[model samples]
Target: MPPFAYRRSAALLALAALLTACGGGSDDDDDVGPATPPGVRPVAGAEGRWDGRTSTGYDVLLTILDTGETWGLYHTGPIIHGAFHGTSGSSDGQLRGSAAMVDYDKGGQVHSSLYGGSYVPQRQLQAGFVFDVFNGSYVAAYERAVTTAALAGSYTGYAGGWPHPLTLTITPDGGLGLTPASTDCLVRGSIGPRPGGRAVYDMRASFTGPNCPLPHGASVAGIAVLDGPRLTITSVAPSLVDFFAFQGHR
Candidate 1:
Protein backbone atom coordinates (compact mmCIF):
# COMPACT_ATOMS: atom_id res chain seq x y z
CA MET A 1 0.00 0.00 0.00
CA PRO A 2 1.16 3.62 -0.64
CA PRO A 3 2.26 5.74 2.44
CA PHE A 4 -0.58 8.33 2.24
CA ALA A 5 -3.19 5.66 1.46
CA TYR A 6 -2.03 3.54 4.43
CA ARG A 7 -2.42 6.53 6.87
CA ARG A 8 -5.97 7.27 5.60
CA SER A 9 -7.00 3.60 6.05
CA ALA A 10 -5.69 3.58 9.67
CA ALA A 11 -7.67 6.79 10.51
CA LEU A 12 -10.83 5.29 9.04
CA LEU A 13 -10.47 2.11 11.17
CA ALA A 14 -9.98 4.20 14.34
CA LEU A 15 -13.08 6.25 13.56
CA ALA A 16 -15.16 3.09 13.09
CA ALA A 17 -13.92 1.70 16.44
CA LEU A 18 -14.80 5.02 18.18
CA LEU A 19 -18.32 4.92 16.78
CA THR A 20 -18.86 1.37 17.97
CA ALA A 21 -17.67 2.28 21.46
CA CYS A 22 -20.18 5.10 21.46
CA GLY A 23 -23.08 2.70 20.90
CA GLY A 24 -23.24 2.97 17.14
CA GLY A 25 -22.92 -0.79 16.59
CA SER A 26 -25.62 -3.46 16.46
CA ASP A 27 -29.10 -2.94 18.01
CA ASP A 28 -28.68 -5.58 20.74
CA ASP A 29 -26.69 -3.68 23.34
CA ASP A 30 -26.30 -5.61 26.62
CA ASP A 31 -24.74 -2.61 28.37
CA VAL A 32 -27.95 -0.68 28.49
CA GLY A 33 -29.87 -0.48 31.79
CA PRO A 34 -33.25 -2.19 32.08
CA ALA A 35 -36.32 -0.14 31.26
CA THR A 36 -38.51 0.87 34.17
CA PRO A 37 -41.52 -1.31 34.75
CA PRO A 38 -44.81 -0.14 33.31
CA GLY A 39 -47.36 1.45 35.66
CA VAL A 40 -44.85 1.56 38.48
CA ARG A 41 -43.49 5.03 38.19
CA PRO A 42 -43.31 7.29 41.20
CA VAL A 43 -46.04 9.85 41.54
CA ALA A 44 -45.59 13.26 43.10
CA GLY A 45 -48.08 14.67 45.62
CA ALA A 46 -49.77 11.34 46.31
CA GLU A 47 -48.88 11.33 49.96
CA GLY A 48 -50.90 13.65 52.14
CA ARG A 49 -54.23 14.15 53.83
CA TRP A 50 -57.34 13.63 51.74
CA ASP A 51 -60.83 14.60 52.84
CA GLY A 52 -63.68 13.30 50.80
CA ARG A 53 -66.98 11.40 50.68
CA THR A 54 -67.49 7.80 49.72
CA SER A 55 -70.04 6.59 47.21
CA THR A 56 -72.09 5.39 50.16
CA GLY A 57 -72.31 9.02 51.28
CA TYR A 58 -70.08 8.57 54.31
CA ASP A 59 -67.40 11.13 54.94
CA VAL A 60 -63.84 9.81 54.72
CA LEU A 61 -60.44 10.91 55.89
CA LEU A 62 -57.51 9.23 54.16
CA THR A 63 -53.84 9.69 54.91
CA ILE A 64 -51.04 8.34 52.78
CA LEU A 65 -47.63 8.36 54.39
CA ASP A 66 -44.41 9.05 52.51
CA THR A 67 -43.59 5.39 52.97
CA GLY A 68 -46.74 4.46 51.05
CA GLU A 69 -48.58 3.15 54.11
CA THR A 70 -52.21 4.26 54.18
CA TRP A 71 -54.66 4.81 57.01
CA GLY A 72 -58.16 6.14 56.75
CA LEU A 73 -61.59 6.35 58.35
CA TYR A 74 -65.18 6.63 57.16
CA HIS A 75 -67.82 8.13 59.32
CA THR A 76 -71.39 9.30 59.57
CA GLY A 77 -71.89 12.57 61.37
CA PRO A 78 -69.29 12.79 64.13
CA ILE A 79 -69.07 9.09 64.78
CA ILE A 80 -66.45 7.01 63.02
CA HIS A 81 -68.07 3.95 61.47
CA GLY A 82 -65.02 2.11 60.08
CA ALA A 83 -61.28 2.28 59.58
CA PHE A 84 -58.78 0.76 57.19
CA HIS A 85 -55.01 0.29 56.85
CA GLY A 86 -52.96 -0.88 53.89
CA THR A 87 -49.99 -0.27 51.64
CA SER A 88 -50.48 1.94 48.61
CA GLY A 89 -48.59 2.85 45.44
CA SER A 90 -49.09 5.48 42.79
CA SER A 91 -47.94 5.92 39.20
CA ASP A 92 -49.01 8.36 36.53
CA GLY A 93 -51.85 9.71 38.65
CA GLN A 94 -53.04 6.19 39.42
CA LEU A 95 -53.27 4.76 42.94
CA ARG A 96 -53.69 1.11 43.96
CA GLY A 97 -53.67 -0.89 47.15
CA SER A 98 -55.16 -3.71 49.21
CA ALA A 99 -56.38 -3.10 52.73
CA ALA A 100 -58.16 -4.60 55.67
CA MET A 101 -61.25 -2.66 56.71
CA VAL A 102 -62.73 -2.87 60.17
CA ASP A 103 -66.32 -1.87 60.81
CA TYR A 104 -66.75 -0.37 64.24
CA ASP A 105 -70.52 -0.33 63.75
CA LYS A 106 -70.54 -4.10 63.49
CA GLY A 107 -68.50 -5.00 66.55
CA GLY A 108 -65.20 -4.72 64.65
CA GLN A 109 -66.01 -6.95 61.73
CA VAL A 110 -62.92 -7.11 59.49
CA HIS A 111 -62.95 -7.36 55.73
CA SER A 112 -60.24 -7.33 53.08
CA SER A 113 -60.51 -5.52 49.80
CA LEU A 114 -58.50 -4.13 46.89
CA TYR A 115 -58.69 -0.49 45.84
CA GLY A 116 -57.58 1.71 42.92
CA GLY A 117 -58.08 5.29 41.89
CA SER A 118 -56.85 8.45 40.18
CA TYR A 119 -55.34 11.52 41.75
CA VAL A 120 -54.29 15.06 41.02
CA PRO A 121 -51.46 16.01 43.31
CA GLN A 122 -52.49 18.42 46.04
CA ARG A 123 -55.85 18.62 44.39
CA GLN A 124 -58.09 15.56 44.50
CA LEU A 125 -58.33 11.79 44.69
CA GLN A 126 -61.02 9.43 43.42
CA ALA A 127 -60.70 5.84 44.50
CA GLY A 128 -62.85 2.71 44.67
CA PHE A 129 -63.35 0.91 47.97
CA VAL A 130 -64.75 -2.43 48.95
CA PHE A 131 -68.36 -1.36 48.98
CA ASP A 132 -68.08 2.18 47.69
CA VAL A 133 -65.94 4.74 45.88
CA PHE A 134 -64.29 7.83 47.34
CA ASN A 135 -63.85 11.34 45.97
CA GLY A 136 -61.74 13.67 48.09
CA SER A 137 -59.77 16.87 47.95
CA TYR A 138 -56.44 17.45 49.58
CA VAL A 139 -56.50 18.80 53.13
CA ALA A 140 -53.93 21.48 53.73
CA ALA A 141 -54.03 20.70 57.44
CA TYR A 142 -51.82 17.71 56.71
CA GLU A 143 -49.00 20.03 55.79
CA ARG A 144 -48.92 21.40 59.31
CA ALA A 145 -46.37 20.12 61.78
CA VAL A 146 -47.54 17.70 64.50
CA THR A 147 -46.30 17.81 68.05
CA THR A 148 -47.21 16.32 71.41
CA ALA A 149 -48.08 19.71 72.85
CA ALA A 150 -50.44 20.45 69.99
CA LEU A 151 -52.43 17.30 70.78
CA ALA A 152 -52.47 17.71 74.56
CA GLY A 153 -56.07 18.24 75.52
CA SER A 154 -59.25 16.56 76.73
CA TYR A 155 -61.36 14.87 74.07
CA THR A 156 -64.95 13.67 74.36
CA GLY A 157 -66.30 10.96 72.15
CA TYR A 158 -67.68 7.41 71.85
CA ALA A 159 -66.00 4.03 71.49
CA GLY A 160 -67.43 0.96 69.83
CA GLY A 161 -70.76 0.10 71.45
CA TRP A 162 -69.91 1.83 74.69
CA PRO A 163 -73.10 3.21 76.15
CA HIS A 164 -71.52 6.06 78.08
CA PRO A 165 -69.34 8.91 76.93
CA LEU A 166 -65.59 8.47 76.68
CA THR A 167 -62.84 10.81 77.70
CA LEU A 168 -59.36 10.82 76.16
CA THR A 169 -56.64 12.92 77.67
CA ILE A 170 -53.22 13.58 76.22
CA THR A 171 -50.45 15.01 78.33
CA PRO A 172 -47.78 17.41 77.12
CA ASP A 173 -45.39 14.48 76.87
CA GLY A 174 -47.71 12.43 74.62
CA GLY A 175 -49.01 10.06 77.28
CA LEU A 176 -52.59 8.98 76.62
CA GLY A 177 -55.28 8.10 79.15
CA LEU A 178 -58.67 6.89 77.99
CA THR A 179 -61.62 6.19 80.28
CA PRO A 180 -65.31 5.60 79.90
CA ALA A 181 -67.64 8.00 81.68
CA SER A 182 -68.91 5.39 84.15
CA THR A 183 -67.13 2.19 83.30
CA ASP A 184 -64.10 0.35 84.61
CA CYS A 185 -62.54 0.21 81.18
CA LEU A 186 -59.27 2.05 80.76
CA VAL A 187 -56.77 2.29 77.89
CA ARG A 188 -53.24 3.54 78.20
CA GLY A 189 -50.94 4.46 75.35
CA SER A 190 -48.37 6.84 73.94
CA ILE A 191 -48.50 9.03 70.87
CA GLY A 192 -45.95 11.06 68.98
CA PRO A 193 -45.36 12.72 65.65
CA ARG A 194 -44.48 10.41 62.80
CA PRO A 195 -40.84 10.32 61.68
CA GLY A 196 -41.24 12.22 58.40
CA GLY A 197 -42.74 15.28 60.14
CA ARG A 198 -46.12 14.94 58.47
CA ALA A 199 -49.31 15.99 60.30
CA VAL A 200 -49.92 12.50 61.70
CA TYR A 201 -48.94 10.62 64.83
CA ASP A 202 -47.93 7.07 65.63
CA MET A 203 -49.91 5.41 68.43
CA ARG A 204 -49.54 2.23 70.45
CA ALA A 205 -51.97 1.34 73.19
CA SER A 206 -53.29 -1.52 75.26
CA PHE A 207 -56.59 -2.25 76.94
CA THR A 208 -56.73 -2.81 80.67
CA GLY A 209 -59.32 -3.66 83.34
CA PRO A 210 -61.94 -6.36 83.04
CA ASN A 211 -64.71 -4.19 81.70
CA CYS A 212 -62.76 -3.36 78.57
CA PRO A 213 -64.45 -4.90 75.55
CA LEU A 214 -61.10 -6.04 74.23
CA PRO A 215 -59.28 -8.67 76.25
CA HIS A 216 -57.17 -7.30 79.01
CA GLY A 217 -53.58 -6.57 77.91
CA ALA A 218 -54.56 -6.69 74.25
CA SER A 219 -52.33 -4.29 72.38
CA VAL A 220 -53.11 -2.26 69.29
CA ALA A 221 -51.05 -0.29 66.79
CA GLY A 222 -52.16 2.51 64.46
CA ILE A 223 -52.03 6.18 63.54
CA ALA A 224 -53.87 9.38 64.44
CA VAL A 225 -54.74 12.69 62.79
CA LEU A 226 -55.96 15.92 64.35
CA ASP A 227 -58.29 18.32 62.56
CA GLY A 228 -58.93 21.53 64.47
CA PRO A 229 -60.85 20.63 67.62
CA ARG A 230 -61.64 17.12 66.40
CA LEU A 231 -59.27 14.17 66.72
CA THR A 232 -59.65 10.84 64.96
CA ILE A 233 -57.84 7.69 66.08
CA THR A 234 -57.90 4.22 64.58
CA SER A 235 -55.86 1.29 65.88
CA VAL A 236 -55.99 -2.42 65.23
CA ALA A 237 -55.28 -5.50 67.28
CA PRO A 238 -52.48 -7.79 66.17
CA SER A 239 -55.04 -10.55 65.78
CA LEU A 240 -57.03 -8.33 63.40
CA VAL A 241 -60.23 -9.42 65.21
CA ASP A 242 -60.79 -6.15 67.05
CA PHE A 243 -60.15 -2.48 66.41
CA PHE A 244 -60.52 0.81 68.24
CA ALA A 245 -61.73 3.94 66.46
CA PHE A 246 -62.55 7.14 68.25
CA GLN A 247 -63.74 10.48 66.87
CA GLY A 248 -63.69 13.16 69.48
CA HIS A 249 -63.79 16.91 69.89
CA ARG A 250 -61.73 18.91 72.31
Candidate 2:
Protein backbone atom coordinates (compact mmCIF):
# COMPACT_ATOMS: atom_id res chain seq x y z
CA MET A 1 0.00 0.00 0.00
CA PRO A 2 1.16 3.56 -0.69
CA PRO A 3 0.07 7.03 0.28
CA PHE A 4 -2.98 8.45 -1.42
CA ALA A 5 -2.22 10.31 -4.66
CA TYR A 6 -2.40 13.82 -3.34
CA ARG A 7 -1.89 16.55 -5.93
CA ARG A 8 0.74 19.20 -5.29
CA SER A 9 0.40 22.93 -5.90
CA ALA A 10 3.00 25.65 -6.44
CA ALA A 11 6.27 26.61 -4.78
CA LEU A 12 6.31 27.99 -1.27
CA LEU A 13 8.41 30.75 0.19
CA ALA A 14 11.39 28.95 1.73
CA LEU A 15 11.07 29.52 5.48
CA ALA A 16 14.18 28.13 7.19
CA ALA A 17 17.88 28.97 7.17
CA LEU A 18 20.56 26.39 6.51
CA LEU A 19 23.64 26.07 8.74
CA THR A 20 27.21 26.47 7.49
CA ALA A 21 30.67 25.31 8.66
CA CYS A 22 34.07 26.96 8.33
CA GLY A 23 37.57 25.45 8.55
CA GLY A 24 40.18 28.07 9.47
CA GLY A 25 41.61 26.49 12.60
CA SER A 26 45.16 25.16 12.93
CA ASP A 27 45.81 21.45 12.57
CA ASP A 28 45.99 21.02 16.34
CA ASP A 29 43.49 23.69 17.35
CA ASP A 30 41.00 22.25 19.89
CA ASP A 31 38.93 25.45 19.91
CA VAL A 32 36.82 24.44 16.97
CA GLY A 33 33.22 23.86 18.13
CA PRO A 34 31.08 21.06 16.72
CA ALA A 35 29.72 22.24 13.42
CA THR A 36 26.16 21.58 12.29
CA PRO A 37 25.86 20.14 8.78
CA PRO A 38 25.59 22.56 5.90
CA GLY A 39 21.98 21.64 5.09
CA VAL A 40 20.51 20.46 8.40
CA ARG A 41 18.64 22.87 10.65
CA PRO A 42 17.46 22.67 14.26
CA VAL A 43 13.81 22.44 13.12
CA ALA A 44 11.68 23.01 10.10
CA GLY A 45 8.15 23.51 8.86
CA ALA A 46 7.65 19.73 9.10
CA GLU A 47 8.28 19.10 12.80
CA GLY A 48 5.31 17.84 14.85
CA ARG A 49 3.09 14.92 15.84
CA TRP A 50 1.07 13.58 12.94
CA ASP A 51 -1.82 11.18 12.58
CA GLY A 52 -1.93 9.48 9.23
CA ARG A 53 -3.66 6.71 7.27
CA THR A 54 -2.25 4.42 4.65
CA SER A 55 -3.90 3.73 1.35
CA THR A 56 -5.10 0.52 3.01
CA GLY A 57 -6.72 2.64 5.70
CA TYR A 58 -4.51 1.54 8.56
CA ASP A 59 -4.06 4.25 11.14
CA VAL A 60 -0.56 5.64 11.76
CA LEU A 61 0.84 7.98 14.37
CA LEU A 62 4.14 9.69 13.70
CA THR A 63 6.16 12.05 15.81
CA ILE A 64 8.91 13.97 14.03
CA LEU A 65 11.32 15.31 16.64
CA ASP A 66 12.95 18.72 16.45
CA THR A 67 16.15 16.94 15.55
CA GLY A 68 14.44 15.70 12.36
CA GLU A 69 14.34 12.13 13.60
CA THR A 70 11.05 10.20 13.49
CA TRP A 71 9.22 7.54 15.48
CA GLY A 72 6.23 5.77 14.03
CA LEU A 73 3.52 3.33 15.17
CA TYR A 74 1.32 1.36 12.80
CA HIS A 75 -0.29 -2.01 12.11
CA THR A 76 -0.50 -3.97 8.87
CA GLY A 77 -2.13 -7.35 9.59
CA PRO A 78 -0.18 -7.29 12.85
CA ILE A 79 0.83 -4.83 15.55
CA ILE A 80 3.82 -3.06 14.04
CA HIS A 81 6.06 -0.36 15.44
CA GLY A 82 9.19 1.39 14.29
CA ALA A 83 11.60 4.23 14.83
CA PHE A 84 12.79 6.12 11.79
CA HIS A 85 15.82 8.33 12.16
CA GLY A 86 15.50 10.85 9.37
CA THR A 87 17.13 14.11 8.36
CA SER A 88 15.79 17.30 6.75
CA GLY A 89 17.82 19.91 4.93
CA SER A 90 17.24 23.63 4.51
CA SER A 91 17.26 23.59 0.71
CA ASP A 92 15.96 20.09 0.18
CA GLY A 93 12.26 19.32 0.37
CA GLN A 94 12.55 15.58 0.90
CA LEU A 95 13.08 14.02 4.33
CA ARG A 96 14.86 10.72 3.90
CA GLY A 97 15.40 8.04 6.51
CA SER A 98 15.95 4.35 7.03
CA ALA A 99 13.12 2.52 8.84
CA ALA A 100 12.78 -0.79 10.64
CA MET A 101 9.58 -2.43 11.85
CA VAL A 102 8.90 -5.18 14.35
CA ASP A 103 5.76 -7.23 14.17
CA TYR A 104 4.79 -8.48 17.61
CA ASP A 105 2.64 -11.42 18.51
CA LYS A 106 -0.28 -11.23 20.90
CA GLY A 107 2.07 -12.27 23.68
CA GLY A 108 4.50 -9.44 22.76
CA GLN A 109 7.04 -11.65 21.06
CA VAL A 110 8.60 -10.47 17.83
CA HIS A 111 6.85 -12.33 15.04
CA SER A 112 8.57 -10.77 12.04
CA SER A 113 10.74 -7.86 10.98
CA LEU A 114 10.90 -5.50 8.01
CA TYR A 115 12.48 -2.29 6.79
CA GLY A 116 12.63 0.50 4.12
CA GLY A 117 10.76 3.70 3.01
CA SER A 118 11.34 7.45 3.36
CA TYR A 119 9.49 10.72 3.95
CA VAL A 120 8.66 13.12 1.15
CA PRO A 121 7.42 16.71 1.41
CA GLN A 122 4.96 17.99 -1.17
CA ARG A 123 3.74 21.53 -1.19
CA GLN A 124 2.28 22.01 2.24
CA LEU A 125 1.95 18.33 3.22
CA GLN A 126 4.47 15.68 4.17
CA ALA A 127 3.91 12.03 3.23
CA GLY A 128 5.93 8.88 2.68
CA PHE A 129 5.96 5.12 2.35
CA VAL A 130 7.21 2.24 4.51
CA PHE A 131 8.01 -1.17 3.09
CA ASP A 132 8.01 -4.77 4.20
CA VAL A 133 11.64 -5.56 3.55
CA PHE A 134 11.06 -9.23 2.87
CA ASN A 135 8.48 -8.86 0.11
CA GLY A 136 9.00 -5.23 -0.83
CA SER A 137 5.29 -4.54 -0.29
CA TYR A 138 4.49 -1.40 1.69
CA VAL A 139 2.07 0.94 3.44
CA ALA A 140 2.04 4.71 3.10
CA ALA A 141 0.19 8.05 3.32
CA TYR A 142 1.25 10.29 6.21
CA GLU A 143 -0.42 13.67 6.82
CA ARG A 144 -0.33 15.94 9.83
CA ALA A 145 -3.31 15.60 12.19
CA VAL A 146 -5.00 17.79 14.73
CA THR A 147 -7.66 17.41 17.40
CA THR A 148 -10.97 16.16 16.04
CA ALA A 149 -13.70 18.66 15.29
CA ALA A 150 -11.28 21.53 15.54
CA LEU A 151 -11.96 22.74 12.01
CA ALA A 152 -15.51 22.46 10.80
CA GLY A 153 -18.31 24.47 9.14
CA SER A 154 -17.96 27.38 6.73
CA TYR A 155 -15.85 30.51 6.65
CA THR A 156 -16.22 33.51 4.36
CA GLY A 157 -13.56 35.97 3.27
CA TYR A 158 -12.72 38.51 0.60
CA ALA A 159 -9.91 39.57 -1.73
CA GLY A 160 -9.71 42.28 -4.34
CA GLY A 161 -13.38 43.20 -4.13
CA TRP A 162 -14.26 39.56 -4.56
CA PRO A 163 -16.14 37.56 -1.94
CA HIS A 164 -14.71 34.17 -1.10
CA PRO A 165 -16.56 31.58 0.88
CA LEU A 166 -14.56 28.71 2.29
CA THR A 167 -16.16 25.54 3.47
CA LEU A 168 -14.38 22.70 5.24
CA THR A 169 -15.99 19.34 5.70
CA ILE A 170 -14.33 16.59 7.65
CA THR A 171 -14.95 13.02 6.63
CA PRO A 172 -16.08 10.26 8.95
CA ASP A 173 -12.55 8.92 8.81
CA GLY A 174 -10.88 12.31 9.49
CA GLY A 175 -10.14 13.26 5.87
CA LEU A 176 -10.80 16.87 4.91
CA GLY A 177 -12.53 18.37 1.87
CA LEU A 178 -12.29 22.11 1.31
CA THR A 179 -14.34 24.24 -1.10
CA PRO A 180 -13.58 27.92 -1.21
CA ALA A 181 -15.24 30.44 -3.49
CA SER A 182 -13.48 33.12 -5.52
CA THR A 183 -14.56 35.41 -8.33
CA ASP A 184 -14.49 33.18 -11.38
CA CYS A 185 -11.93 31.02 -9.61
CA LEU A 186 -12.00 27.28 -9.30
CA VAL A 187 -10.41 26.05 -6.11
CA ARG A 188 -9.27 22.46 -6.28
CA GLY A 189 -7.79 20.42 -3.45
CA SER A 190 -8.76 19.09 -0.03
CA ILE A 191 -7.80 20.58 3.31
CA GLY A 192 -7.94 18.67 6.56
CA PRO A 193 -6.10 16.93 9.32
CA ARG A 194 -4.56 20.13 10.63
CA PRO A 195 -1.22 19.72 12.42
CA GLY A 196 -1.83 18.29 15.89
CA GLY A 197 -4.21 20.82 17.43
CA ARG A 198 -2.31 23.69 15.89
CA ALA A 199 -3.90 26.69 14.19
CA VAL A 200 -1.94 26.23 10.96
CA TYR A 201 -2.88 23.95 8.05
CA ASP A 202 -1.09 23.13 4.80
CA MET A 203 -3.03 24.05 1.70
CA ARG A 204 -2.86 23.78 -2.08
CA ALA A 205 -4.53 26.80 -3.52
CA SER A 206 -4.84 26.16 -7.26
CA PHE A 207 -6.58 28.99 -9.00
CA THR A 208 -8.46 27.98 -12.11
CA GLY A 209 -11.75 28.95 -13.71
CA PRO A 210 -13.18 31.35 -16.25
CA ASN A 211 -12.75 35.11 -15.91
CA CYS A 212 -9.98 34.51 -13.38
CA PRO A 213 -7.07 36.90 -13.70
CA LEU A 214 -4.40 34.52 -12.46
CA PRO A 215 -2.59 32.19 -14.79
CA HIS A 216 -4.47 29.10 -15.74
CA GLY A 217 -3.66 26.40 -13.25
CA ALA A 218 -1.47 28.83 -11.41
CA SER A 219 -0.70 27.02 -8.19
CA VAL A 220 0.27 28.36 -4.78
CA ALA A 221 1.29 26.77 -1.52
CA GLY A 222 -0.50 28.31 1.42
CA ILE A 223 -1.23 27.95 5.11
CA ALA A 224 -4.48 28.64 6.86
CA VAL A 225 -4.53 30.06 10.37
CA LEU A 226 -7.56 29.43 12.53
CA ASP A 227 -8.59 31.67 15.39
CA GLY A 228 -11.87 31.58 17.24
CA PRO A 229 -14.46 32.08 14.52
CA ARG A 230 -11.89 33.61 12.24
CA LEU A 231 -9.70 32.06 9.57
CA THR A 232 -6.82 33.62 7.67
CA ILE A 233 -5.22 32.24 4.52
CA THR A 234 -2.01 33.41 2.87
CA SER A 235 0.20 32.38 -0.03
CA VAL A 236 3.39 33.53 -1.73
CA ALA A 237 3.88 33.96 -5.48
CA PRO A 238 6.79 35.75 -7.07
CA SER A 239 4.69 37.19 -9.87
CA LEU A 240 2.73 39.25 -7.41
CA VAL A 241 4.13 42.15 -5.42
CA ASP A 242 2.54 41.04 -2.18
CA PHE A 243 1.41 37.67 -0.91
CA PHE A 244 -2.23 36.78 -1.33
CA ALA A 245 -4.21 36.99 1.88
CA PHE A 246 -7.81 36.49 2.79
CA GLN A 247 -9.45 36.89 6.18
CA GLY A 248 -12.62 34.98 6.80
CA HIS A 249 -15.18 34.62 9.57
CA ARG A 250 -16.78 31.39 10.61
Predicted structure with the largest TM-score when compared to the true one: 1
Candidate 2 lDDT over residue span 1-250, tens digit each: 3221111221011111101111010121111123333443333544544444554555554545454544444433222322222243222443334333222222121212212232222223234442221111111112222333555666554432233344544333434334544556665544543433332455545567774423556665445544456544444343332233445566
- Candidate 2 Cα misplacement greater than 4 A, ranges: 1-145, 160-183, 193-197, 238-242
How far residue 242's Cα lies from its native spot in candidate 2, in Å, is 7.8
lDDT of each residue in 198-221, candidate 1, tens digit only: 568999888887877567788998
Computed on alpha carbons, the lDDT of every model, listed in order, comes to 0.70, 0.37
> What TM-score would candidate 1 get against the native?
0.78
What's the residue-level lDDT of 228 in candidate 1? Answer: 73
Candidate 2 clash pair list? 145-196
Candidate 1, superposed: residue stretches over 4 Å from native: 1-45, 180-183
Q: How much is the lDDT of residue 148 in candidate 2?
A: 31
